[model samples]
Target: MSASQAPSQPVPPSWKDLGKAASDILGKDYPIHGSTLEVKTHTPSGVTFRVFGLHDNKSSAITGDLEASWFDRKKGISLTQAWSTANVLRNQIELQNHLAKGLKFELISTLVPEKQAKNALLATTYKAPGLHIRNFVDVFKGPLLTSDAVVGRDGLLLGAETAYDAREKKVARYNLALGFYAPDYAVALHALGNLTTYSASYYHRVNADVEASARATYDSKASSNVNLEVGTKTYLDNAAFVKAKVNNSGILALGYAQALRPGVKATFGLALDTLKLSSGSADASAHKIGASLTFEA
Candidate 1:
């Protein structure tokens, strides 16, 4: 006799399962994507060639200046593509070195990053317990002696990161963090809290450089939809610039990063950037701000 129906058992889903689902969902849309380069010249066909460069795994922020040059043997003038190629290489190099101490070295070439349709979060984890650092620059975890995976129980995330100036001196201060979410607590204890709930387990970082750090940031949802971060950072040694000399270094930062959709974001940031020397001989600073729209990965 044919069975009327096949046996089916309902499977139990645990916190781990839920966490995995969350991670998978979030990891698909990371904020850090590749950069763009634009240069203007006199000629329409002035563009000789373009090199889609990648991080040489040696620099950070700026590309390495290696193949940083393009030849314009015909017109004896460098074209737009040539200039762009230079910046790309330089930017790649800079990014690699800056993140050297961090674990973003692999960020240079990754099918995951190129796959714009899918958000990419590292699937690796710390075989042993470990800590990580976070930074505003690259969109990846730091040199994780321990890895930070997508999902976990108790909902605690631990990480840290740092930033450097053009002179290769560490300037910005970063602290590893722990994010905790007690879903049960939210449901049983509180009712007005069903948001993408997350709270810092802890945030701490100390800057040893000569410059003082003055910075603050607020990331909240209901009571405070404010995203305010400002701080000052100085250098320990006197750093020099082209046609300019300075004895001090400091940065006043302000930014707001918020969610635009379930897995998307809109970001805006501005900073007062400067390099000052102790001798009071040189001073330099610039006003900078940028906007970025991203997916939550």
Candidate 2:
């Protein structure tokens, strides 16, 4: 039977099946299409491509985007490009390239307003083989929308990342991240001129089918409130998945994802505002529902 004729919302699948592959390439920032739907394709030549059709609430006029990504395994590099007519073709073009191994570099360019665009480059050096410690240098040019525009030697961002793995302990793992966006180490030490952000996360694997994590974020520029989040992911039977999370603001969210058919998948998400619910306001905006479908070729 065709996917459209199949049940749109079925009973929750068992939490033990995990056999689906994701096609959206821009990480978690990609849009989720509604009834209008989205489609993706992967080729034997290591190319991943996807198209999205965004429709209005009434399913009227449609607008959307096309994205394609490919990797050159031998060269250890990958490239991705996305374009959409929704932004006048000028502000819709984005290109990104990344190198996977030692002396890694990532460059991203995106069109912006004001007849300008921004380009940023990030370079990383691994401290040692099989070690998690690494150093990063970031530089930006063009418009300031994508950067802090600090320039010169002072504008550069110096960062490092390290992690602790505890899989052998059958317990949990911890991580720490640090970043200094100052021109000099002295400025970073002063902690007054250059901006900085720090984050940490703890992750635990409950079993082959479930995992849980908690994360915290601290921004030197905004020290009043540190952001925190706790979340869990579960793999369901019949190729289904579910994720749920709660943030510091008392916002709770749940999402269900499933592969309805071969090369086809769908996701539904709902979020609730605990504060609003506690206030006894019957506003429907306090609760939200979203769903998207995708077909892979």
Candidate 3:
């Protein structure tokens, strides 16, 4: 040994150092900070209420919404009303098990009231008796506008769901989606020809408390982008849970949730910017931190 090199001096923890460490681990992806809070309660008479709040760090704004829903078990119907900070009100009704035993069918309708325009969304879901296959149709009415505002036309979104139980406790699923103008539904004969997008996913149980899944999707229109995401969830002791996710773009995120009490919980999340590491730009590494609290009674 040329004289045992002096032990490297330990570096103190600093924001920059932390950023560099995260950059080294994550590679090129960036994260933006956001947070949410939720509270839910049920009255003795069976009425349920929920409130949600969200915060955006970049915008430094907090927005909230509230919803009250009640289910009539005897009638298999649910009614809900939700109001958001944006002055939008949504009234919804859901009917479950609307059909006899031959098939299981559910229908849901939502009406949104706004000063600019009134909108409605209707959806129907059908499931096989044994729950092996499922199908759905959703229709949106009103002035539906895209970013370009060129396709501000009402449309119907049709989809089908099918799953296969693979060997060794693995499962695979496929979802086919199609979108077309509501006026053209009759002319199209509800064809699957205009396949707008489709997604495939596979899930496996790593163990009783852990599961992993991967999903890939492709869009035929709207920029024609393909996305892939892989994630895992682990159930920890004491009503705690953790999740980790990585996207095809190399972004990584970790989330932890802890139950503070029987009806209260807290959650924390961290996302690392892996992309900056690949480009050797640790200074530009963008990491995010978010936290939320939830209560249910």
- Give the top-scoring candidate (TM-score): 3
* Local accuracy of candidate 1 as per-residue lDDT tens digits, 108-196: 22222333422122222122222332223333433222222222233443333234443434343333333343422111111112222
CA-lDDT, candidates in order: 0.30, 0.50, 0.56
TM-scores vs. true structure, each candidate? 0.22, 0.55, 0.62
Model 2 scores a C-alpha lDDT of 0.50
TM-score quality measure for candidate 2: 0.55
Q: Rank the candidates by TM-score, best first.
A: 3, 2, 1
Per-residue lDDT of 195 in model 2: 29
The worst-scoring run of ten residues by lDDT in candidate 1 lies at 185-194
Residue 220 alpha-carbon offset, candidate 3, angstroms: 6.6
Rank the models by lDDT, top first: 3, 2, 1
Which one wins by lDDT: 1 or 2?
2
The candidate with the higher TM-score, 1 or 3, is 3
Give the Cα-based TM-score of candidate 1 against the true structure. 0.22
lDDT of 3 by residue, 1-297 (tens): 243663432222221121122222223122237788899999876689999998987788999999999988776778888888887777787777766432334444444455565555444443331122333333342222111001112333233433333233332333333333321111111112234565544445567787666656666675567787777777888588787888877777887878999999888888876876665567443777788888999
RMSDs, each prediction? 20.0, 16.2, 19.3
